[model samples]
Target: MNTQPTHRPVALCALIFAFLITTAAADKPTNVVLILSDDQAWTDYGFMGHPDIKTPHLDQLARESAVFRRGYVPTALCRPSLVTLLTGHYASTHGVTGNDPSPKYAPRDSEVYNQRRAKLISYLDRFETVPEALGKLGYLSHQSGKLWEGSYQNCGFTHGMTRGFPEKGGRHGDDGLKIGREGMQPINEFLDLVKEEDKPFFIWYAPFLPHTPHNPPQRLMDKYSSPDRPITVAKYYAMCDWFDETCGQLLGMIDDKGMRDNTLVVYVTDNGWIQDPKKNGYAPRSKQTPYEGGIRTPIMYRLPGKIKPTERTELVSSIDIVPTILAAAGASIPRDLPGLNLMPNLTSGDPIERDTIYGESFAHDIADVDDPEASLLFRWAIQGNYKLLLTYDGEVNRYQSTHPRTEKRPQLFDLIADPTEQTNIAAEHPDIVKRLANKINAWYPVKKRKVLTTFQ
Candidate 1:
């Protein structure tokens, strides 16, 4: 008959609820959405000083995010650049060097310069991705649009609506053309599906727009098309605006589903904008070369409560994305991966731990070379504000130390002073040049063919 005793159980339950609320508030899962644009320029947005490109969504995202003022891609090409982004390793290390058709896809390895054999080896195989690692920690991993080369199915997506891009599929890889709403529609639908799911998700989206064959809806094209403005510029801006609208749509879904505050939204491009091939005197080597116009890209990371709106001049690379996402999700980053966690920067507005970053492009011009495409390699290291680029040609098995002809003397630039990389400071700072060169030379061979080919 002690009815008062029941009050003790109610009080205990209330105390437990308070404790759980405090814990949940202290440790919330950071939902991640990485939006990647193909061939988007670093300075093409309103925030980055484009005179006319309309990117309202990106500009808004920049205001709400930590915008990396000096974001560079490790590779200029999509397949290799993306490989570096996901795996946080260089193409040389990942072994997906050039977009050459591997032996399996080639008429003859010799005929195609033996680029096909390397295509058979995927860069994705070399390391565990952040999403995959997140999945290991009980997070839902979903991706729409471009994930990676031929094997989108095996790129470790829990639920993927990615259509096979040309990079995948062949006798060795799939060559099927992807026309018509490949990833966008599916992305919208996928967002609807996961709105009610109770688990955290990491959505890796790479939209195909503002790339080659610049096509936009007729209405979008008409919105920007005019008689007085530059035709190509108008078209490019139109494409970019349409892409930005798509971003708004995705973000709208998050807001509509009541997930904005809990989500960490990031937007980036695979590489710098491809200088218009149709426009003369725009920039030499639209892509496939390591230039500001080829490597620097737009990056926006908005982790609502975590990252404050600020411009971070500290240089960050695509390599940092892997560790950043893993750290945000409270997932484990594999010891072997070369990426550094960006939690400190995102949460506290601190600089990146890495002072220097490396970039590589293998066999970019191998088709013209007589020897094996695998024999050609390029290496670079950026330290402080200086960068050194080295090119290697000829046999991979016969690398020598003093091949002066093969090794172009290092070209160094003070990035802070000349963001355009127009000045070569290697001759002025001989000591710095020698130090960086030696470091690059020593670290260069670590990503040898043998190391790349070794599969776990």
Candidate 2:
């Protein structure tokens, strides 16, 4: 036999090694980054066709994403909406229908309030959260900002900044709120650790930006402020710009780490906000109401070479987020989840099978921790071009003083014609109203529902 090895065997061995490396890379789990904008209107973004507000990074994201302009959360409040995103369950199903427990039950700073809050947080134990589900797949998750439901550990986050509720300065985010406002150090550190360990990561980056305190940098304020634009409006717009800058920083960091190709980024707003022209607060029909400005947001998912970028006008919900994420991760989706897996729609360009999406709006304060209907204010359904909002009898709560339900009737709008929801065509289209009302009832079957106006 010849001493020299055959060239054919050497070539075969090289090909085998290459094949193994490709397979391993393909099998690597994708990193997920959930970016939640707090209290941003659907129409405020540059990509969404706002006249003045500039969100360059988000516009870029929208271009790279499967943007759904008609996305709506089940509830139009921060806590419940965030809970829905985490669990893929509606506010009613998750039993966290409000931001806080009823103040009537206990004073805000009293031990009783803390106890009630603890009880409210306990509701999360009933369902599997996005982080909890991903944890089983060896994903290291970090909770950075706007976490209301107790600690990051309680929510299955491996590392996080929230100290949990009842802790000092722990109502919403606590120290976690510092992520975007102060700097990106916490997230940067977490990303570095993930790279070192060679493990998949999930980041919950729900910064309390563009929500309140409308205090942007002087440069941004100056850029937005004008003679016609009220100071309040200018401040709000500037806050949006600030939020976009933070998002740009985050995406840039990911790109710098060379992880953009393997990371899946999802963007959504917790709820919508319309700043008052004359005041420093949210205007009516937005934030805590069932109107479009309150409930609607531009939901986007960007995964390079995975999800095709396209604008979808069909109705989608925040409920679909968990299933979509799980499906992308090759994990088992819980059969009981009411939301649809959006992978097909996103990747294959298939239409969402369902024709209608439903939502429930509850009081700002939880009337009962166990009963979601106790705080139920409105149950709305969007079917095709028509939207039906059925008002229910419930406590308005102390917080809704600025914007209370003035019309105690079943309001129906042709969304195609009246996107602003200025006109109610319930009487004109009783048949459509009844059809949507029936659909809502079939979905929720609320026993405590006291409809202000019947469709008869």
Candidate 3:
């Protein structure tokens, strides 16, 4: 009908309404769900192209998220790496190296061991954690699985099941570590509470699956275990699948709640675990050693609407995760934190800036609780497809390292060319070694470059 006059006004009103809705949606508070896998191998995921592993959920997540294949953690050990993730500081910067001091403390000295463990737990009080930061802005946060930072309250989790207090036998997560292995009830309950409360939320789902106690469910074990397969390998493989299922349960909870679009899920392993070829144990190079397997992990950030899904080749670090989450949540990030805010890069689909990432292998116990540099067994730096590892002769609190250098020379690997790290081309390229060594020392200076154990 004769509607020319009405059409323009109606269109204008519709545009205004759409703009308001978009603006409101954009300004809505964001929630964060950080999935830190514990003691998992960098190569064990189907997404990472592992032949034996069947991590369908993680694979799907990788497809839908911005995946960085070259992601790394600063330390190979669990406690320190977890601390770094919490504080957005390296083990050295945070001054909490290794899991326990028993390796350094006197043998049979249970008294000293207990004391040192308590000291390490209390040490985290000095730094501001991610949860505490978000909680201040009224974000409800939950902690489950592998929480070494004292009690959940000690780490600023408003709600958590684990009691990490060392005195109460809460070393490295206690009952909290049972989250994934048992069920994701605590996490799902926390999610329910957050929804009911109508508040922004943060979740730390750092489960201890595929870690130790590699006792997978019977069906998972049946799939991997057989007379031909090594028992240890089968169990470990089964554990990986179990962990993947646990991850699916958690993600499914999010989807069931209809909060997937607004929630940001960040994934990274605390450190790599290489199952020993012969035994039910981890190999040196894979776990506590300064090798590709120790430091290498995939970093994924998924926010369906905000960040596009793309596989990124550029080197990214675990250090960047906290800053990225904070940015996504519209929270103010600490200026002094070293990690780059990867949100802009992920959203714009731009190449991540810069090269060098640092790592250290340290005593299972602190060499000196106050000195991170002294505690280090090895210091490494990665840049432009090259990785250099250096060992120093002495630090005041240094102890004998199980993964000591046998040859007193720098070990350099071209990670791009040799992903498995089968060959060390350090002799072939001394200049590259020198450059990377210099970078490592610049970040964490080496007092003496004697390469203590002549490790090759």
- C-alpha TM-score for every candidate: 0.81, 0.96, 0.93
- Candidates' lDDT values, in order? 0.66, 0.89, 0.83
Which stretches of candidate 1 lie above 4 Å from their native place?
1-19, 25-28, 102-105, 108-123, 163-183, 226-229, 277-282, 364-377, 394-407, 446-456
Poorest lDDT segment (10 consecutive residues) of candidate 2: 396-405
Model 3 stretches astray by more than 4 angstroms: 1-18, 103-112, 394-402, 448-456
**lDDT digits (tens) for residues 1-456 of candidate 2:** 789867998899999999999889779998999999999899999999998999999999999999999998878999999998889988888888888889888788788887888988998999888999999999999999899999999998999999977788788988988889888889999999999999999999998798787888999999998999899999999999999999999999999998998889999999999888988898889998889989999999999988998999789998899999999887899999999999877988988899999998899988877788888889999999999998887776676664466677899998889999999999888788888888988996878757854644
- Candidate 2 vs candidate 3, lDDT winner: 2
- Cα lDDT for residue 418, candidate 3: 91
Top TM-score prediction, candidate number: 2
Cα displacement (angstroms), candidate 3, residue 96, comes to 0.7
Displacement of residue 133 (Cα, Å) in model 3 is: 0.9
Tens-place lDDT digits, model 3, residues 166-259: 5476778888888988889988888899899888999999998889898999999999977888898999999999999989999999999988
Clash pairs, model 2 backbone: none
* Predicted structure 3: lDDT: 0.83
By TM-score, rank the candidates, best first.
Answer: 2, 3, 1
Q: Which candidate is the best by lDDT?
A: 2
RMSD to the true structure for each prediction, in A, is: 6.9, 2.4, 2.8
C-alpha positional error of residue 374 in candidate 1 after TM-score superposition, expressed in Å: 2.4
